[model samples]
Target: MERTVGMSRPELIQVADTVARDKGIDREEVFDAMEQAIQKAGRSKYGYEHDIRARIDRKSGEIRLARYLEVVDEVEDELTQVTVAQARRKNPEAEVGDYLVDPLPPIDFGRIAAQTAKQVIVQKVRDAERERQYNEFRDRLGEIANGLVKRVEFGNVIVDLGRAEALLRRDEVIPREAFRVGDRVRAYIADVRQETRGPQIFLSRTHEQFMARLFAQEVPEIYDGIIEIKGVARDPGSRAKMAVFSNDHAIDPVGACVGMRGSRVQAVVAELQGEKIDIIQWSQDPATFVVNALAPAEVTKVILDEEKHRMEIVVPDDQLSLAIGRRGQNVRLAYKLTGWDIDILTEATESERRQEEVRARTRAFIEALDVDDVIAHLLVTEGFYDVEDVAFVDLAELTQIEGFDDDVAAELQNRARSFVEERNARDESRRVALGVSDDLARVSGLGGASLVALGERGVLTLDDLGDLASDELCEIVPSLSESEASEIIMAARAHWFDGEDTAGDSDAGNDDAQTGSDDAGDSRTDD
Candidate 1:
């Protein structure tokens, strides 16, 4: 009966409102879904072959159903199209490719039809809700949020964030931390992934950024943008370090973050289950910052190996254990905080190593520069480690050293230069005997030294040079960059294919001398 369509018009709008509010989606979207469901149902009853359409009035909740047919010159699909000649009976001025709509009477739904319609509507609404949730939470990444622990399955805690469920995985939570139902939770929005099932809102309590955000919330100076958190490293519920900087010189960043009597840090520690926090002042100098990062331990000296991004921290023997912490946690966190590899040593160890390095440099200078032990020791103490430094330094810098006159400085420099010249000549003579190409030295990137070095490695031809990689070239000659090596290699490879046709022709000539014009095995068989 027609009453079945109109019986619950008010209930239809009410259900739309309820679903929109519950799903946190737009109301019009739900109405659009309902119309699509009704349209699908209409197609089932009217005939699946027909183009059935349905629409509900948003204001009055009135439903309209129609069967659409396009006027065509030829009847291709009879169920969806009507011939122009046949359409003239319904409308006198009908044209081809025009949709001819026919009003259809509403039909009562069977139980199966109603169930299918419900399923379609529910599926469409669910898809829309997922899209809405993804759009809502995608921009909330890197933000802190609060929710209620809805439940815990296995080890993953599902937090109900009012409108959506966020996942706090076991590994993302601080170690040994647990939660139960109905407990309040706070976490950083580490990631928000829109998956096929739904939007997975991943939360994290152990992330370094989480600690940074907590400081921003607890410290007003950080929130007001007066102080900035430069970096943070966490051992997660055990220990952590936060580096802060103050734009205002008057306000100390460390004092501001620590608050009065460590109130701010204590609050963050309480949240993290008593994780000891060291709020260190960030410095522009890496050595200074490393010293600050390794706090509560007196640093006697810091030796930096900048090329390797490593540091040697010399502490008092008694403070060595304190600086390293229990199970090397302190030094490990310092490495993370400063982005440097660190080695902690006592002053006694550093002194022994320093003496050994001095002895080694003295021996190297005595052998290379042909100087006496006292002069070699003097050069080493004056920071001249290699023969190249002695040869290349300013003549005045060498003369300025104690117990060295202009004649001595001149003699040392001349010997240094002569020693290098003799070495290079010897390397060059070996290179010439090795049959290394003179054209290799002609390449601008390959200097005399690099060419001789390559010759020593038995790289003799352009083809061999081209076949070599950039890193191989660098390993042979340490001064060349990869780009410079690549340029020279590509230049060497330029003539590789140039002589290909001639070489192939020569091979063909050799084949002409064969017993037969065939492959090697066939030629042998003919012979």
Candidate 2:
């Protein structure tokens, strides 16, 4: 039996080497897995409670099996641990905590045990293989990968990338695109995840970075870092836009990306199934960049609200359809490329809207300040939209307006202040009628109008105000800034902490009274 086992030892090492090479795992790991499988078989043949272990000699491939017994002052588990006296009987000078190894004879292979060991080895090798794949691909994110289509199931393509496999889901593929088995495919490695089954790699053909990467491969200047891709927005399979910038002054970024007679761009378009691409020059100024992004259509005017990140684009009536593209694709791409909320308007529409705004502001001033249409129009022309602007504005500003002397400016400011006072008084009465508490009204940043708004929303007490988040308060009162609302809420919560401090003080006083009574009782007992 020993001669037969020795003869098979070299074959075991050869099998381990083959499995390690085929599965792309370390040979040492394979040996460790084999040893664990042998140890499991040995435990089954011996008693399950025994601590059996197995080792393989690296050079000679000889197998060794042993049972480990620990020396202890008391033996709780008789099979795995022995008393110090019993351990010393086997080998004198054996001390507590020493592990004694007992050699065991090799057992003949049984069919069931062999199958169990095979399963264990297979499972361990598979787990090691998955770990290897996950470690190799996790760092390769945001890169382009080329592979063959292994199979397609329900519109999702499974790509075989030689060393690993990746999935291209249906939504991630360009519209109207299809792939068949064994077809060559290229995609961007969007994500990689380690799951229970194995490592999963997700690929995308319609990702914005896919276009950027393709351009880099086509343009030498881009690959060499002379030109940089600033942004990309895609309506996949129909139209897309890319913004590129060149560090070299002499090199035209747009012309370089377009290539000689559009050869380079054409190659990328072909790979994407003829998706149309518009390459635009990038700019540091937002207005200039937006203008460039909305190419092939002239921009007559651009009104930007920097605080809101919104842009009102005015184009010629004839170019409205072109600027908006087929179903608003052009302006949509421009919005994504520039990170702006865009509203496209025709030149006629913009002009009409501006006139309407001026008329509206004039009407507002006439009603609020008790002024005539002529004065209101003049105020609107001077860019004073509301009574608050007239009330809080510099007296010099009003005097600077044409046809406005010091007396006229002074009268306007007085009326504006009176009107504001009356509005506040009215709002205060309404707030009181709504049952809003005075404590809530006294919150430092809470104005009469804000109190009325909060009361109408059923936030009628200090506790109610304290329970609200800053964003909820802003929703109820739009005029209050976020910081102001936060301050008001903090002030409302101050009373809650004050109550806690009062309770703590009361507890301390009661403890002192109890201690004084106990001292008096002790003194009386001494007397």
| lDDT over C-alpha atoms for residue 357 of model 2 | 96
**Candidate 1 per-residue C-alpha lDDT over 82-130 given as tens digits, one digit per residue, 9 for 90 to 100:** 9998888877888987777787777577897898889988998999988
RMSD of each: 7.3, 3.9
Every candidate's lDDT: 0.88, 0.91
Clashes of 2: 0
- Model 1 off-target regions past 4 Å? 1-8, 72-75, 83-97, 429-527
How many steric clashes between backbone atoms does each model show? 0, 0
Candidate 2 lDDT over 1-527, as tens digits, reads: 01222223777889899999999999998999999998899999997899998888787787888888999999999999999899888778899999877877776669998998899999999999999999988989999999999999999999999989999999999999989999999999999999999999999999999999999999999999999999999998999999999999999999999999999999999988899999999999998899899998899999987866888999999999999888899999999999988888999999999999999998888888888999999998888877889999999999999999999999999999999999999999998899999988988877788899999999999999999999999899987767778888899999999999999999999999999999999999999
Error of 1 at 252 (Å): 2.3
Model 2's alpha-carbon lDDT is 0.91
